[model samples]
Target: MTDLPLHELAIERHIAAPVSHVYKIWMERLPEWWAPKPWTTEVVEMDARPGGRSAMNMVSPDGEVSPVEGVFLEIAPEQRIVFTDAFRAGWIPHPPFMTGIFAFAPDGEGTAYRAAARHWDEATMQSHSEMGFEAGWGAVADQFKALCEETWVAR
Candidate 1:
């Protein structure tokens, strides 16, 4: 096995909701919690199966749109999801950026949700850290909590 990057950015939150519920929202209600206030998410193409396509656009308050296109490397419903920006649908090569893992596990009666971003090198990792990984992810987590807490099991 090859060595991984020396830098990583991760954030975990104990969401006051079941893992199943959290996963449901993650898949279906992503646009609801995927972005913080003043920004919104729009899924252009998403298929959660392995090797499936996942693409989304983040619209900023100033009307700027940024798209993230990737392939689903792995998905275990209510457990975890891994996706990489290195490849698009059909396994086509794209500019490698980050491989992210979103994991959800049972935490008491709630869910222990973690988001991990792996970089290919130290430079990339440092770039992400300097790009407000903590604040951005923190805002996203809070938004997720609000969405799940409000919707509960209404899916």
Candidate 2:
């Protein structure tokens, strides 16, 4: 079994868009500019309700596909979202299990978005951190913010 430790990684950024618009971009149109490294997600199923399933197939650059399935623990439109990786669609708990929380708040003329990912344990956190979690997520967040801003302007 993979080691499970308690750990947290929080990233916050100010997106130049209204909270509602930013949230829509995140949940409704994420596939657009989600990542530039050739990763795509086909949301197999999404209920967006507590105890409901949210599953997606992530296609890698090399044409390999992997499924990332989880459950939505909480969701507040334009405000917050929480999900857990404790149970996948068809698999049991695996290594580095995590719970992710995303929060959005009004910041001046924009939205302050924060994402906190809590892993099962310190070892798992260390492993993910070493695997470039900061850089990878940072890049995605940057891209997301840019897209949101562009969309906001076009609106």
- Backbone collision count in every prediction? 0, 4
lDDT of 1 by residue, 1-155 (tens): 86665467999999888998889888999998788788999999899999999999999999999999999999998999999999989999998989999999999999999999999888998899999999998899889877887788564
What are the candidates' C-alpha RMSDs? Answer: 1.7, 4.1
Least accurate stretch of 10 residues (summed lDDT) in model 2? 88-97
Clash pairs detected, candidate 2: 5-120, 5-121, 5-122, 6-121
TM-score for all models, in order of appearance:
0.94, 0.87
Off by over 4 Å in 1: 1-6, 153-155
Best model per lDDT: 1
lDDT of 2 by residue, 40-98 (tens): 76778877877778787777888788877788889999999998888764445544368
